[model samples]
Target: MHLILEQGDLTTVAVDAIVNAANSSLLGGGGVDGAIHAAAGPRLLEACRELRRTTLPDGLPVGEAVATPGFDLPAAWVIHTVGPNRHAGQTDPELLVSCFGRSLDVAADLRARTVAFPAVGAGVYGWAADDVARAGVAAVRSWDDANPGALDEVRFVLFGPAVLAAFEDALASV
Candidate 1:
């Protein structure tokens, strides 16, 4: 599996799928979630609404993922996963790991050859960038090992240089 770190807009990624660090609501909130919803246009929200009415009545639980059409975004699909928030008292590192793992699991089910991810809990959720990088990289690496060549590439599309550096460091360690 090819792992890459790129510093850019997640909405611009032309991958088969891009992972959104969403809240349980599945409805758009701040950070990556809001930006993705905005970029993907109103239809994205409508799709999410349909999901809420159907499968995710309560909301997407932490570490679980569900996919929706990318709408106006460059990606073909948008995979949304709720990360564990430290400020909210969800501090388990494994939950962060599950965010990456389950997103990939969903991508694999969709036959997505390329996927992009943001640092799952590194924003308003208050997760440290380095810790997020470690868990994110490890989960992707572990999934790659278990699934063999299921995915061609998994890119961490960070918005800033610092977080990108952390992901690069984590990749080097792996």
Candidate 2:
């Protein structure tokens, strides 16, 4: 996969899938999750509700990813993954890495050529931007190395300058 570090809105990215940094409920919370849910319209929430009813009865676990239709968004699919809550004492970097790797795995299963990702665990979850960037970039790079042609492009669609800079540095080193 060709990794791109971009500072922009995840909702408008033209890709096969956009990975949402969702909560366990998948019912749409704040930050990237809220933005994606809002941009994709009501159908996105409806789909999430259906998933909760059928597949994810308890709720999506941290670091696990599931796919839903993008609805009104530009992407064909919306991949939702719950990141670890650092403030809640979930400080494992492996779980943070899983957020990226599992999302890529889901995208590969969907045969998605391009995917966009937000800075998972970096907002209300209380993870530092630099740490998130390192784990995210490393996870994606590791996956790309393991699965040669799985995806054509994977963009880190950062929301702000600080995170974008962190991701850029991480990308450079990786």
User: Backbone clashes in each candidate structure, one number apiece?
Assistant: 0, 0
RMSD of each: 0.6, 0.6
Q: Which residue pairs collide, candidate 2?
A: none
Our tally of clashes for model 2 stands at 0
Q: How do the residues 1-174 of candidate 2 rate in per-residue lDDT, one tens digit apiece?
A: 688998899999999999999999999999999999999999999999999999999999999999999999999999999999999999999999999999999999999999999999999999999999999999998999999988999999998999999998888887
What lDDT is obtained when candidate 2 is compared to the true structure? Answer: 0.96
Q: What stretches of model 2 exceed 4 Å from their correct place? A: none
Model 1 misses residue 155 by how many Å? Answer: 0.2
By summed lDDT, the worst window of 10 consecutive residues in model 2 runs over 1-10
Predicted structure 2, TM vs. truth: 0.99
TM-score of each predicted structure versus truth: 0.99, 0.99
